[model samples]
Target: MDMVQSNQLEIRHISPEVRKLIKMYADVNNCTQSEMLERMILEWDSQQSQSERPPGDEDE
Candidate 1:
């Protein structure tokens, strides 16, 4: 048997109208919805970790 680690994900179904809206955003950004979503999550994570720094560190 083999096992693989995975990031937990929540999935939901949305109406066609909502999907169209999401598609518009994705197209404007030149990215797929999943790509956009992943980017968003990464951005949020980076923002949350931005305050963590060692002493003597200064913005360059």
Candidate 2:
């Protein structure tokens, strides 16, 4: 269990409502709060890069 292999992070606070929602969803899916957040960030990282845009971008 080395520190380098761990998924460490720092997150800012959110409203109570959002916190409750996150907890509820995590409970239903049987995952920790941090785990759910990590999954979301990974999914975002999987998106296409800026240079790989589709056609019809010459006007910009």
Candidate 3:
């Protein structure tokens, strides 16, 4: 399967500790910082979608 191309994302005002944690996580996971962030975003989106669904509507 072909991977989709990602556009650039620029964020500012993050604390140094958070930046260090992200870097550490990326290192442990063997992925770039951008990839780690993308994964985190996708997971967060999935969680949000699941929570937004009505109860007992799991089949949808």
Task: Give the number of the best model, judged by lDDT.
Answer: 3
TM-score of 3: 0.74
Writing each residue's lDDT as its tens digit, candidate 2 over 1-60 gives 432224334334556786677678779889876676566566667664544777788678
**TM-score of each model, paired residue for residue:** 0.51, 0.52, 0.74
Worst 10 residues of 3 by lDDT: 1-10
The full ranking of all candidates by lDDT, starting with the best, is 3, 2, 1
Q: For model 2, what is the error of residue 24's alpha carbon versus the real structure, in angstroms, after optimal superposition?
A: 0.8
Q: Residue 30 in model 2: shift from native, Å?
A: 0.5
The TM-score leader among the candidates is 3
Candidates 2 and 3 compared by lDDT, better number: 3
**Residue-level lDDT tens digits of model 3 in 1-60:** 212134124323456787678779989999877677667778889999989999989776
Each model's number of backbone clashes?
0, 0, 0
